[model samples]
Target: MKIFDLAAGADGPEPAVATCSRKACRSEASWQLLWNNPKIHTPERRKIWLACGEHRAWLEDYLQTRGLWKETLALVPDTSSAPIGQDF
Candidate 1:
């Protein structure tokens, strides 16, 4: 299944195509890693990192290594729903 933020707003525009966040991996995104840097973002602020199946672990591990990972959640397709105006 795909992943996204449960807290992410569910009524807005979604991209026609999303690519993995991992460098060099152009696969379509199937997961969304929700995270925040306490030093940089507020408590309610959660950032996103989209990942494909192959790079999911690597990207998550990359965040864990930096102690920036908060959680991982699936992004449901077919709804054309996602937080609008969210940027990487």
Candidate 2:
């Protein structure tokens, strides 16, 4: 399921911020870790994990150990008018 921080004053549900993928981490994410399991996912399918500065290396190492890591890049907020949940 998708998890999003609630915008306190908004009438409809809205995303307040993008958070780290690490469990129980509430810090805002600054990096995007791209990965996928070769055994389960196609080569072109990329899965994303958001990571805060403090956890980037840890998350990368975890993925790398499993031979799942593809790349790491700075997180850039999307400005397009695409549907919220379509990409995943």
Top-scoring candidate (TM-score): 2
Q: Evaluated with lDDT, which candidate comes out highest?
A: 2
Q: Which stretches of candidate 1 lie over 4 Å from their true place?
A: 1-15, 81-87
**Per-model CA lDDT versus the true structure:** 0.77, 0.79
lDDT of 2 at 18: 66
Q: Can you write out model 2's per-residue Cα lDDT over 1-88, one digit (the tens) per residue?
A: 2233254343545545668888888798889999998999999999988889999999999999989999999988876534333122
Error of 2 at 32 (Å): 0.5
lDDT of 1 by residue, 1-56 (tens): 22444443465234566778887777888888998898989989999998899999
C-alpha lDDT of candidate 2 relative to the true structure: 0.79
